[model samples]
Target: MTPEGKALLNIVILGFGFMFMFTAFQTCGNIEQTVIKSLNNFTASGYTSMSIIYGVFSASNLVAPSVVAVVGPQLSMFFGGLLYSAYIGMFIQPRVWSFYTASVLVGFGAAVLWTAQGNVLAINSTGTTIGRNSGIFWALLQFSLFFGNLYIYLAWHGHDHISEKDRQTVFISLTVISLIGCFLFFLIRKPDTSEPIPSETAEGLQAESTESISGSGTPRRSLCTQALDAFVKACKLSVTKEMLLLGLPIAYTGLELTFYSGVYGTCIGAMTRFGHDAKGLIGISGILIGVGEILGGGLFGILNRCSHLGRNPVVLLGLLIHYLAYYLIFLNIAPDAPQAPEEGTDLQAYITPNVGVALFCSFLLGLGDSCFNTQLLSIVGFLFKEDSAPAFAVFKFIQSIMAAVAFSYSNVLQLPWQLLLLVVTGFLGTMSFFVAEWKVEARRRDSAYDSI
Candidate 1:
């Protein structure tokens, strides 16, 4: 098969694999705070588990590139998928010790899985197609949100509490779907690296080749040495000028990711006014969020194909939408609603609960997320074409740390405080991205002139 054909095929595989795996993971996550609390009578256990996952994920990224180097991207991804499957399986029984343990393991798995995914994607895509490829992959993967949440709405819509039988059935099915995704990872074939990279990608990177990470002609070395070198490279990359500038934006994405993924849904489910209808509302929110994400992914992917369009516009759009979402969340969701449910002393919000408005916020959040994430991926792929692995590792490392911090504080801070932080972070992140982008463009123009 042609290289282009293989690239497209692999992207599809990644999309479908993640769609199935996350379909289970995301749905479970959406209900985690409520379901786990109901099962064990522990109030913040779900948030704690999520915090643990991102905490470990942050640490694991330090070594993920090295692991990918030794094991290869395909094998590394397969191992990571296996870990995710294990985490979901633990839910079938739902023990505190086992649940937390699985969360830790899944954290490690997530780092390697996402890092390897970046490696494979960078290898297959050219400068021209990178945005399109990332878009396709994101759009397909977001489908999990649709299917998984739809199932929840169908099965558990009106119920306030999930039964033991229902819990077992849901988890068992999710585990099976995740396992199928794991198998799909094993089927991926890495693209041939012997062919010359296209001029569009090679223009400013003439001195550095795509094979730099392929380890094509390098002599055999100890796995320990390779890992150490990769770790050092990731550390060094983190402090580089471009990365330093881009850090805030990358970290902001992580913060917002936590909010939309788990926090907001919990708030929707916990509001006393919603009563028994909360579960159904959460499902509807999830479905709309998916729709918004899919639309943004496809739209940005097409826009990215036009060279003059750049990425800053998309970033600005995301910033504005997210601010709007936060405003709605502040006005409608009580500051204490997410953590305490009906138990909190504070129940009054600026606006009375309205299901339609809440769902609108969810959709806007998803769309804004797609805009930030797709642009971030494209920027990394374009700027760090040669050292994609270590670059991606650095991105995840910082992003996960921020995500961990966000989750940890989710239990302590009120919704108002959290919205304030997000707004500030979003502004800073977007400005940082603009500066980094300008610097990259200036450097590229200088290089072009030098060549002439």
Candidate 2:
């Protein structure tokens, strides 16, 4: 096969593999807080474990690029997949120690998995193809949400309460599904690194390819030194003007991601009065969220390939949709709905909470998320082509920190206040993104003029 054909194949394999892995991972994550909360009303183990996962994920991002450099993207991804499988397996027979330990390990796994994913996509794409590749991958990856939740909806739809036996059965099945994904990762053919990727600086490419050569044709820097250099390079890149400007939007993605993935589902689960099938609402929420994400991913991923509309407009549209979702959520869900459902006590909501509205809000949230992430990946791939791995590591680092902070407060903060925070952050993040886009365009024009 040609290099282009091979690149597309690798992209598909990565996306397909993640679809299987995250089907188990994300489904379990959506319900972790709720299920654990049900098991032990006295402890905040669920939210706390998630918080730890992101916290460790944030810290591990510092070295994720370094690890990718040493092991290469393929092995890095395979190793990360192994860790993800271990985390999912813990759900079958969860212990407090095992749960928290797995959380920490999975955090490290996420860092490498995402960093390696970015590296592979960047290596496989040029400026022209990054958007399409990102879109295709994202569209495929979101299918996990659909398949995973469809099972939940079917298994627990009519049942009011989930039995331990049912939970074990579901988790056992998911664990096996995740293992299949691991095997797929093992099958990804390594991309040819010899081809010159447009926009990558010679120096950056050389540095990434090796540490240094010796007079006797031996390596100069130790493997550990090379890894340290990668970490340092990532830190240096994180402080650049472009990356700094992009940080606001990147951080907002993390915050908004936590809201929909963790907090919003929790709120849905908490609403006992929504119907007799309150537990089932969580499954419905996941499925619709997946639908919304798939639509956005397909539109931006495929349609943009034809139009080349750039990233800014998609981000602006996402901002508007998010605003709409937040407003509806504020009106429909009570301020303290995420905390718990109270019986016989009147909840303070602007409108009576309708099940349809709550689920619709989830869809919007998912759609908006795809808009932000797909564009973010495209933009970063274009802007930092030479240093793709570090740039992606920095993006994940900031995003994970925001997610961790949001999760820490998810249980304590009221829904209204949380929505208010999102509104303010969204406005600022969108504006920051525009500034970054303008700067990049101006620089490109100047470079062209210089060539003339």
Candidate 3:
């Protein structure tokens, strides 16, 4: 195939697949950030439910590397996405057991899909173009949030309260979209990678190829064994001072996601002040976030292409943006803002949501979020280019676990403290990059000595 065909295929296949899949999952899952909350209203803590999902997502790191190692990105994404479709189906019945079980399935799939997607982006694009490609991926993937929000707005725009049936319909719609996304994933051909990462060894590729078509000669390892080995290597790597420091920020990414997409949407956007128009406002928040992501991601690419600032600066900028956004949220709502549906009932009767302020926060959250995530993607994919799967898995594992922690505390914590924690996490994350200057300097010195 021509270079153009390969690039086109990547964009069409992965791009649409990511967009539609998230559209189905995040839409029904995220709207007003209340899906899990509503489901857990009678039986459990919403944050606990969400934490189960994220914890499962983190644990996927154990098995995802081996899966990708054997089957390659194309099949990994397809199968992982198939699992995602199944998880979405479980939402039809929102029982605790169902939520937790589905969470595990989706989490495992998320690890594979995300790990493959990142490696795919790195392998497919040139070093010069990687940032731009990453930006494109992020910007397009976020469009799902906008589309999902719009569907919510159109369907339940004027209702003061949505019926369980209406909610079921929402889940059903999302499930159909997710199923379509799984199909798109299958259309993605195995990449003929130009700049394959180190983990994509020629020997491994040959083994996979031979095994696929002919059988025999491919050494087999049990999934448990593969996962264990990957886990051990990644854990050793993860504990380095630099990695631990970097982890501080990656952890924040999860926390930020839960805040923006989880209960905050329901607490601040849905019940605060919009009244019957709350659903529409929630959808609007998604649109603003989507638009902001487009601008932020596109700008990241442009800056990478046009300037020498590289990625670290973008991380710094994202941190500041988040700080400012959180400040706005705190000013409008109480520092002790409760994110639980049960706790929010009183606030629903009384709390004032500063629409202008809160919506602005949403925009910044998306913008800043894109900046942090996109840059992180570029940096990690480049840094761990050789051991891509394990490295990416560890990084995501950090992100998922941290997010799980944050989500677990969502019900107990106040907004002010949560935002403060975010600031701390962002600082640590950014500081991690800054500390890497030493590593870069050491490498340069070693290279210089070798040349001499």
Candidate 4:
């Protein structure tokens, strides 16, 4: 490819990457809201039903890593995209069982997309550039959430009063967009096949060497020796302590996902309690959050270009911002403040302070969160070999599990405790830096020994 052509290809791929991440998250957001709205419209008891749907969807996170490992990231992406498209269609004619089945498909597919995209970026980008690219990817996703909420708001505007035909029309439009997104997967060039492989003769020789080594011992002794050898190899390569450190920030990311997913509902509920018009407030808040994310992503990308400013500090700052955002949300939902509004007024005085707080928090959270996310990826890339997909997949699996637990816990706990969970997350986010530092020191020591 010419220089211009390669640059254009990169841009196109980046745009598609953004869209894929955006759609994955946006579709997940839409499903939850759509189910609740449909249930309310049908005058059916939906709390329990919706809870079950979310649980099944959340559980699918646990299996996504395994799927990626078995099928390869490219096929996994295709499967996820198709499954997401199908779920969108199923959502149009939702039933209790339909919602449940669809959630499972969507959740599983999302996991696949998440894993595949991370691997694709890692394979294609170098060092800090990976961080910049990841920031762009995440920014698009945040933008999607910002607008997706607006789409839901407009679709069900005066949802309490909309006709069934109007609702159906809105759902059909969303379904169409989702299907188009799935088709776009075809545009992603297959992952690079440039890495050289061992020839057949080399492989055969290696197999014979392995067999001769095994033949030197009796069967039982060989089995025992093999187990010991495998254990030692695992111990040498595996960074168990480092992995644990990484898990902390990942768990926090999971908490953030849970909070953000339910933020609209929380905002609406809080506004209603304060006698405000929640619909308008939510619409405005969503746009502000989207704008904030774009700014945040851009800022992070710029910082990544600087050698001195690195990933650790950026992540630390992001965690702090994320913590504050949730704290503000908790305050917005406090019970003692006010009453529901009188019937005729479109203006809601109760939401002014809440919206102001949320907007500021959203901007900070977006800036910090996206920065941290990019930094995390960079750290992982630095710490592991090129073929780190399995490790990445495992990390993501842990994140999904944490998110599932947090989401379920939110149903029973207050906002304050949920926000507290983020505090723990921030502390954990620092672990990657420490681990990276330790690994550097260890390598230095090993080099010193070899020199001696």
Candidate 5:
């Protein structure tokens, strides 16, 4: 194909890939709600069964990155999607093992989808453009999640009084979506091949190019070499006495991941505790989050342009808002209080001021969380190189580990304490931005001195 044709094909493939990947992501997000509803109706255990499902999925995130590296991104996604489809299908049978197995498959698929999507974004863009592209990609992915929940809600609503046949229908529909996602993988064009040049050759080319750009000036390395050098520089950025200050941001990133994942789940639980029906509250929260995400997408460029405080400060602010949102939710739930009686037992006793507070908290949670996530991506773009897919992948791997921890802990912990844990997690997450900032500053200083 001609170069223009190839470029067009590349763009088309990337767009379709983004859409499919986002769809896959939405499917993953919808699973918890689906499983919870299905299990509640099918078994007596109800919410307890849902917790087990969360644990299985959480564990899967811990292992997903390595699995993706081994399988290649495309195949990883395909396998994940196909397996996830089968897992959802198994829910038709409604055994304990089926739920467990399905949760694992869903987790595995989500991991692959996230990793592959990042890789695809990396392959398609460069420089600052990479960050912008990634932000847009992620924002849309979040939107897809909103729609996924809506789709599932509609499906459930249509079969409101779900008989065995209706349940089977839901499973079959999910399976179809998963399989379609898998098939969509074939459309993703392979990334361009640019073999890594040796450091010496890269330096030489950079020097020559620098000389050409600046007549009578000393030669400097090429952009590619500069980027590789930056990566090496980032690795050597240090975590010692002087560098300890910079390591703060990396640490904060971890904390944020823990807080966000954990608190969101806890908020949903809190809502349920406050007499809001699980179905209604989850759907509302999803809608609020979707709206927040749209707002975040619109604010991306504006936030990126604000250089006075820089990306790190913006991220910190976002995290602070998120922290407050979670705190509000926690306060509303009164975690230490005794569990309210079941639905039929004095329903009026359960309905009170606490319920209103919880609903508001859910809305805030969506808004604050979306802002923080958006800023976090922008910060990653500013701090890392264009081809920082591997770095970003590693970052996500760490985030997933933290998320898994939070998810698991939510299942095991009580209400008030879980909120406390989330707060601590968010604080730690906020600290990661500082670490990243320090590293960036140190690199700037080092680069300046190296030139001297």
Candidate 6:
């Protein structure tokens, strides 16, 4: 198969794989209420799950590049997919042990999957196609968010509590979907032609224009040694000026996700802190997020193809969308503040973020999100195409840490404070990337000269 064909297939398979897991994650956002039904918890169940999940996930990046180096991208993803299914399987067991263990597995799996994905997409794409491919990938992945939320609306809309039957059914179904994602891994074509890239200077440039995941040559070392060497090399690369320029934006991916998926729903979706059930509303919001992602992805994808309207412009437009959504979301934060409201009545029903307005906010949030995520990945894939594994591993690591931090503070921080933080930090994140774009332009010029 042609490199482009393989790249397209991998992207599609990954989108399909993500659809199930994203849905599974979104379905029971607050597992304490839905699955565990814990009454004595201080932290929100959403935080509990995200912290556990991303905590482990972040830690695993230390080894992801090496793992990808040793096993190759396709097999790495296959293993990751297999482990990812365990997360959904946790729904069936619902035991504390099952939950935490699955969280670890899923976290490690996510690191592996993301590392492989970045490497795969980066390896196959050229400067010309990177932005479009990344956008397309993000667009396809949103189907999971859209359809998952749709499933929740269809199956559990009216009910406050999710039954074992409902949980189990969704679990079983998405589990199969995840397994299918793994199956697609087998279809990916690994490059058996490239020699060890002893020095990826000329070879790296050639590799980028061709099909090679490890742009650096593979040394004949033991698995542990290979991974250890990769880790050290990757770490050195991570601290370089070029890579550090991207830190803020990469970290923002985590914060954005945590807020959109976790905090926003908890704070604004309900009619009151404890009044109307927000599950249905949040589910609907997920659909809007998916809507925004697809639209943004599509727009960026198109613009990326045109030299006149490439990545930077779309990302700038995303900043506008993000700020707009921020104000829209602000409208939903009731002055009365959030209470556990698990059992009590909502005091300020009038101000609940559960109307068309909230939906609009959600749509904007999703739309805005597409710009950062798709573009960041594309930038990393293109700029560090030769070192895609390490660069992406670093990206994933920061992303996980930011997510964990967001979740940890989500409950303790006041609604106003959280929103304030997101606003300030999100702006910083985007601007950081904007600055990094200049560096990328310089690098691209260098690459063009080298190719010449």
> lDDT of all predictions, in order shown?
0.80, 0.79, 0.69, 0.52, 0.50, 0.67
lDDT of 2: 0.79
Residues 303-340 of candidate 5 have per-residue lDDT tens digits of 66756565566666666666676666555554422122
Q: Give lDDT tens digits, candidate 3, residues 1-452.
A: 87746865676668888999998777655552455544445465556766877898887666665677667777778788887777677667666676667677777888778767765665556555554565577667878988888887787776665568877898788888988887886676544545433333211222233233222345465555656766787778787665665676677788898888775566554353545666557777777877878889778867977876566788889988998987777766655445545223434222356677778888998899988887776666556666655666677778888879988888688777887888777787778776664465566579899999
lDDT string, candidate 4, 1-452, tens digits: 64334433543564564464454445345234424443444432222333443454445544443455445555667677776666656645667566567666666676557655555444444443444555555555555666555675665554333345754665567666665655665565533333322211110112212223223322333433443443353344345666667777776776676555544344453344333344434444555556766776677767877756456667767766776776666555543111112121223332344556755765665566676666666666555544343345445556666666765665555555666767676666666555664675577579899999
Model 1, clash count? 0
In model 6, pairs of residues that clash are 197-217
Worst 10 residues of 2 by lDDT: 209-218
Candidate 2 per-residue lDDT, tens place, 290-330, comes to: 88888887788765577655678999999999999999999
List of clashing residue pairs for candidate 2: none
* Each prediction's number of clashing residue pairs: 0, 0, 0, 2, 17, 1
Model 2 stretches astray by more than 4 angstroms: 1-11, 40-44, 68-75, 118-136, 190-221, 301-310, 341-348, 448-452
Ordered list by TM-score, greatest first: 1, 2, 3, 6, 4, 5
TM-score between candidate 2 and the true structure: 0.87
**Positional deviation of residue 416's Cα in model 1 after best superposition, in angstroms:** 0.6
Q: Judged by lDDT against the true structure, how good is candidate 5?
A: 0.50
**Higher TM-score: candidate 3 or 5?**
3
Whole-structure CA lDDT of model 3: 0.69
User: Which is the winner by TM-score between candidate 2 and candidate 3?
Assistant: 2
Candidate 6: lDDT of 194?
Answer: 31
Q: Which model is ahead, 1 or 5, in terms of lDDT?
A: 1
Q: Estimate each model's TM-score.
A: 0.87, 0.87, 0.84, 0.70, 0.68, 0.78
Task: Give per-residue lDDT, candidate 5, residue 396.
Answer: 52
Off by over 4 Å in 4: 1-14, 17-21, 24-38, 41-78, 115-143, 153-166, 188-239, 273-277, 307-310, 335-353, 428-452
Better of 2 and 4 by lDDT: 2
- For residue 427, model 2's alpha carbon misses the true position, in angstroms, by 1.1
